[model samples]
Target: MLALLSLPDVALAQQKARTVDDLAKMYDVASCKQCHAKVYEEWEKSTHARSLIGTGRTIGGFQGMIRAGLMGAFTKSGVKDVGDVKVEHLAQCFKCHLPQISDATDEVARELVKAYLDADRATLGKVNVNCLVCHNTKAILHKWQDGEPEKGVVYGSKDGPHPDKYPAMKNSVVMKEAAMCGQCHGTGPNFEFPQPSQCATAYGSYLHAYIPAGGTETCQDCHMKKDGKGHLMPAYRDPDMAKRAVDVDVEARGYKFLLKAGDSIPTAVVTVKITNKAGHRIPDG
Candidate 1:
């Protein structure tokens, strides 16, 4: 006799036919974890992973900052109370903090923001930073188009299996360019600051100094590859990495008499020098 087996709910869900747009909307860091387990695990410990909640080094993350900004904007705009502040006004905050939601319509984004305002933790958690913001090679294309992604295109630095299913699986050189990071890290209007200012000017600084000085290395070379750890781009988080970027020295001159021999004290001159070995200026961005 033959035995019949039933598919699990998750298996059934995965088996359901989905358009590329639906897949893009459904995919998250957890989905990526199904295949790239090691990369997912490493990213789980990274600053990018905590970018939404502001854990680890990000203390009081983007959510807190956005709320503060909304409160201030409402106060300045003569809105009577925090409850009166419209969610639509605050939706732009998702661009960097929650790129997936940001790509959705303003109406959809407003609903998510409203959920957060209503103290719905589950809805807020859904908006946390995800994988595709960086890894998606067609991020630029998707970003500018303002609609569902092309039907069967999947962009990345490498080609994946099932090219017949995903026709846009083309290798992209932009993934390896410093400008790729500049999409977020480069100069941009400062949302947190009250006064107008450009935030995250690392790309501009690198171009102004590093490129002009005949430096050919990309940001990934120093931050990602220097330690042989792929995704953990250590900056201030690693003391050794920070130290490698610059050298410090101290020198003291001999004491000199400043007054009459019996009545005066001598003073010594101390000098401290810091030499930046990195191509760009120290404390970039």
Candidate 2:
């Protein structure tokens, strides 16, 4: 016998379509499109889009791994006859390469490959660094689910969509901080691998050079702003940003050359320290 399930059935049937906000609440970046149209547009053109899409880089890295027998070692029956070992490592590759979908690890790689084949070859190359790579970021930690806001991210437009329902756009501190960049830029246990895993040293350079020196510069300050950084996040992508980051700051003072020290001229102490002030527990590789 079937009892009447009126209100509960109606309620269940009437569930509304999930908004980007709803998706964001569940850590799905598919929702970021609600307000980040400009940044997304730029990212679509840049290599940022290819962060997850299949690339020779992935093949090359994996092939190198295969040659090293990392995949072959953990197989069930035989070495050459090995099954896919640590396919999870592909996900790790996407942690930075396809950050938006990284949180949606449930089905990122297949979706990426599908998306890539559907689009132009040129489009596929620029997939990893996507639209919200830097702007929507609160911090640059490895885990998508755990980025902390070093400061709150502020927005310029009043009507722009945000996690907060209000239209006010002040106290958006997250956008101007170094920690936001450190999520992906820093080194740690997760990155201490034989292969290049962490960008911590790069992030460290930015922090120490700019933050401690009383330079109100963030990663974006030098790489993005100094030369029209634009949304592409060209610091790592474009040669221009690399050249721009390279600059000579001449701070000259007369050396005392103290003989009384009785040391090897103190080794010409040129102390340079880089910081990853951005907060995120990077993997302990």
Candidate 3:
């Protein structure tokens, strides 16, 4: 047996968080506010911050996914109810919503499901896609090329010695790439699971439709750079961001015309044109 002291940092770090509280402590976001006050404030208002507890919709979605899908006859997931849920079962939804759930135990998965099912806001709010999630856990898209995310190292735009809990900070090769956001923003259908899910497909449209149609801007170029909202990463939900994403033109005209050199005829014409100026398809998940 491998002694605890001799275990590799990755294995030791992810010794399997025992509960929702334990997972929350593993990737605590509150501590980051000390060093990143402004960015943290922006993130506080983002969908990522409220991933599992968003306007009652996200939690409601999970309740349905669990009751109607995971526990339903269609999936054959080998579960009769939420009580039987495990980490693999929740991965369908939590893969992006609360990715840190992966490090947690099956009991934690069951607990989270019940919490969401009952709309227990306090407990559901315990975890989110926070600093450690983006700048660390999910920073590297290709583990083979960039190596697995280190336990204590934080990935960012610059390489240096971070001041607080995270002792190291290294620049990630894909941090600024659209693929970074694509990791969660997703392509069509996540085939990683047995029953495929079509949760998010914005990245797919961005590549196939937006880029193919002479669009050059990237996801970050617009969301983080042009919008300049930083961690907020506003999308269709924000009125201003939604308005700016598309351009609409309406034209109406009424006129009278002589029909076959006989009686005068009245005519009306109207035209509506909508141009999608954003980097991807409008109304994409």
Q: Among these predicted structures, which one has the highest TM-score?
A: 3
Candidate scoring better on lDDT of 1 and 3:
3
Better of 2 and 3 by lDDT: 3
TM-score list, all predictions: 0.66, 0.48, 0.87
Candidate 1 vs 2: which has more TM-score? 1
What's the distance in Å from true for residue 36, model 2?
Answer: 6.4
Clashing pairs in 3: none
How much is the lDDT of residue 152 in candidate 2? 33
Per-candidate Cα RMSD to the true structure, in Å, reads 10.1, 12.1, 4.9
RMSD of 3: 4.9
> Model 2: per-residue lDDT, tens digit, 1-285?
977759976574344212222223433344456677766566555545554433445445544444454435534312342232222444445455545443433233333333333543443343345433454443333435534533334343232445743223433344566665566655333543334343335556545554565666566665456666456555434567544434434443444466676643433435444333321221111
Model 1 agreement with the true structure over 1-285: per-residue lDDT tens digits:
976546785475455323323323554446566666877776777666655444442334433544665555435633343445443454444445555543444344445445555654444544445456665523443344444344454556666653333445544456777876666566556555333444566787788888998899988888778877667666655787779888989999977675875766767899999888775666754
Candidate 1: count of backbone clashes, pairs at least 3 residues apart or interchain: 0
Please report, as a residue range, the 10-residue window in candidate 1 with the lowest summed lDDT.
15-24
Please rank every candidate by TM-score, starting with the best.
3, 1, 2
> What digit string (tens of lDDT, one per residue) describes model 3 on residues 1-285?
875554676575469897889998888868789988999999999988988987546777888888888778555788887778888888877888988887887889998888977889899888899999999888998888878999889898898998888899999988888889898888889898987878788998998888888888888888877668988888888877888899999999999898777788999899999998787777876
Q: After TM-score superposition, what is the CA distance of residue 104 in candidate 1 from its true location, in Å?
A: 5.1
